[model samples]
Target chain A: MATKRKQRMIFVIVLISGFAAATALALFAFQKNLLYFYSPSQLSEAEVTEDQLFRLGGLVVEGSVVRMPDGITTQFSLTDMQGQVQVEYTGLLPDLFREGQGIVAQGKLNASGLFVAQEVLAKHDENYMPPEVAEALKAAGGEHPVSIPKTTVE
Target chain B: MFTFLHKYASPQYFYSWSASWQKWASIIAALLMSVGLYYSLLNSPADYQQGETVRIMYVHVPAAWLSMFGYMVMASAAIVTLIWRIKVAEIMIAQCAVIGASFTALALITGMLWGKPMWGAYWVWDARLTSELVLLFLYFGVIALSGAFDDERAGARAAAILTLVGIVNIPIIHYSVEWWNTLHQGPTVSKFDSPSAHPSMLIPLLVMALAFKAYFFAVLFKRARTELLLRERNTSWVKALLKEAV
Candidate 1:
């Protein structure tokens, strides 16, 4: 019947959206914290209460990454280029954690301007950067801004 | 007898032509794959940053890519078969279904192996991985639906509809890592402006992709020939050809 074509269209849309929503719900459920969070600049400006845990995003500044000899505690300066914040944490860093890469840390800032980070996530080198972080970097006059390569251009 | 308006001039012509093309395709695909494997495994230098594990990118990336590419091809053929009722396009759906499914599964398995060492987890229920898993299931669904009926034509029709409907997953898989907080890495060579990987790495990856394409064509022609033969089994030309061979 002519309704077959309409039926096909409906089927396709329903399937696509169904898969999308299913994952969306699953991600929400699994990541109840869903902690892809705010940058250092945003955190500094916010009127946060004591022990109010939240995310802090920015890049780890060069020459600022130092591992403690104990290997359990470390400190680094996170920069948005325009402003910077010092973060102090006691834990193992992510393997991809290094200087000059984008990251989001979860914790609260002490009055001493130190971020007592509970968790730090480093972005993968698949050339993907969060849009918010990229914008912050751009506003900071950009350091090593990602340039698309010159050849085999597909 | 493949006599749907005689699109091939003659079924005999199609068989002979396809046979020759199939021979050449297999030869080229073999040569290309050997060279590609050589570069991927031995010749290429390890990524200075990611160390030797970066080599996984060669297979994992291309296989993931072809999985999506194969589905797109299948969906297009489905549309062609629906409107023109081309038997070859329907056969293509069958061929593409199996090839695409295998590649999708390969992408997933390799991804898991690569993830455990690098990402610190064997698997995460994130956007990129989950969507790709859905893609593999869709291919399986197509393969099952297409062969479900006692009537072959009816089966192909049902399979074709499902294949077209499943086309939405291709983009989802490609952009999942980029669009979400998934632990998956983003595209390296797929970007048109500039690729993230170095030329040394990109070249071998591209070569391997070409090899995969050539292999797809080689197998495709092989399967299509068998399909053509069976579809034309009742025709006079097929009988003549078989008699001559005997």
Candidate 2:
């Protein structure tokens, strides 16, 4: 009986490990496709056509937001600290959207190499603190440096 | 230790032992939840960026944590059922499935609510979100598969195998943010050494997490005890216990 139980244990372990290994190999094969969005640097190298829709994620470059005369359309530059992409979107941005904040935009590139975004979503980092604590950190010049520089103050 | 475990593994023994444990767990869970709610909703400072919307984390994160924790418990019970053919472990799988599914559903709902105002979308097909959704389906699958078989033991064995197979999704859910470029943010509380959240916020999050754990165990023990009673209805111990109750 004891030997039978041990055999069952071995069998269960082997079954689980085999399933896990198969899943791991499958995930590895489709690693690039699994990425939610491509960084500005990756977008530059990829074989993207004007007609293909894709997501671009990066920091909103400081001092790059330009509101069109119509007041609905906005143009901004997104950068991954290595490469930059010009994005134009006409919509209400999320509450967290601001200069130097990270965001993901889904859109297609136009003929002039401009990204025409249909949707813009803000992506917050892991940091969380009260307004006062943030102020204190900034005063001390020891603010938690997100990927982008803390140049714009809300 | 083995003998002790074996003794308690019996439904008759566990039924009596679990009653007082359930009572104590329920009381502690209630107390902790009250305190945790106070700290999380009132005492905790709001996020600089998210403001009051960040309060959603207290519910969302704990629910997400419990969803995974419930699966881990089910997986452990699955192993015991497979190897030892423990009757108690089999019952545990059925009981855990309903509770785990509820928590997974709660996590997903609260996440969508939080996402709309913060992430600007109600849902996204990101890796983290998608994996968590898969966990919910896995829980439902376990519950449905177990109930599908007429023979209870056979049903449990099948469910246990499925549970073991689904265990692969747990790590994927955890590391999805790091493994892929996800819209969801990375780890905050799990980092331990240098958590990004302030202590005021982190403390409340931890309190809420503990409260959820206590609540989970309380519900699990209650459900398991009731299941043990039903399963052992023909046994003499249960008859005596029922007589005593009457």
Candidate 3:
């Protein structure tokens, strides 16, 4: 009985450890793509090459959007309130895109250090800011912004 | 300790104890669920950003947590059955698979609804969502495998082994948001020194979580009772139980 129990115990350990190893390996291999986009502040801190593609996120500061008269290119200043980056995109933005809204832009930095956006995502209601944008703002300003209150219920 | 555990293995003891506990658990579950739902739907403050849609968190978080918790319960039962040759644990695993699967489905559906407004898309094949879908499949596999064989014990044994192997998915489901750049948001209430959600929202979310837990066990006991009846049909105790009912 003792030997039988020992053998079963060994089998259980091998079974669990083997699965854990597989999960660890898969997560390790896919680590790069699983990462979320960087914020303007994070982009500034990192040593990303000008041509390297990545994600940048934050709020579109009010009145910062400029549409080239040609009507294709739009420029906007993205900020976490403490630090800011200029983003340039040449495409029709999501319908919900507006000033003071949170957004995530994907593309590369140009030689002039301006963000040349490939695609932009924004579909938030007037009152809502993306949680990611709020988090980045908190990190950049070193204080949780009152814009996203912890709760409204008294 | 061994004898104490083995004592409950008699099936009769477990059945009687579970029957008594089931009523109380159901009452607590009902009371808490009603109160939680009231606060969740009517009173809890809307998120500063997500607004009314943030209300989904009340159901979404609890359902998500229960899915993982149910899997753990099933996996632990799988381990107990293998190690000690416990019959009740096998029955418990079968019941847990059903309950866990329900919660996983709820989690997935509610998550998609919540994501649509916040992320500008209903679905993303990201780490968090994919792993949760996989967790659902694992539940399906266990339920199917446990009933696959003509020989009952052999079927149970196979299902138990599968569960032990698939248990690795639980942690992956939990940490997915943190580990990857998924569209899904990160932990708000759980990781911080204090919950990130405010007092009004946080309180109800917690109440809902507890309500789900109590509800899981209440339903678990009922299913386990039925399982014990079917699986032990030939035993003298079950025969007596049926005869007494008749």
The top-ranked prediction according to TM-score is 2
Using DockQ, rank the candidates from best to worst: 2, 3, 1
- Higher-ranked by lDDT: 2 or 3: 2
* Residues B1-246, model 1: lDDT tens digits: 435444663446666877778888788879888988898888886754456777787888889888988999898878766655667777789889899999999999998888766654566666688889999999999999988988777788889878866776777677665555445656777786887665767788898998888788778878877887897899898899899999
**Model 3 per-residue lDDT at A128:** 25
Model 2: residues with Cα > 4 Å off, grouped in runs: A143-154
Writing each residue's lDDT as its tens digit, candidate 3 over B1-246 gives 867997887688888888878998999999999999999999766665776888888898899999999999998888878888788887888789999999999999998887766666677666788999999999999999999999766777788899989988888888876665455665767755755566677789899999999999999999998888887888898889889999
lDDT string for model 1 (A46-152, tens) is: 56776788766677888997777887888998876667888888887767677886666779878676789987766455643334545676789875552211111
Q: Where does candidate 3 clash, by residue pair?
A: A34-B181, A35-B181, A36-B181, A128-B49
TM-score of chain A of each: 0.58, 0.91, 0.65
Query: What is the DockQ of the complex in model 1?
Result: 0.16
Please give, as one word, the docking class of candidate 3: acceptable
- Cα displacement (angstroms), candidate 3, residue B166, comes to 2.3
Among these predictions, the greatest lDDT belongs to 2
Tens-digit lDDT string for candidate 2 (B58-151):
9999999999999999999999999988899999998999999999999999999999999899999999999999999999999999999999
* Candidate 3 share of real interface contacts: 0.35
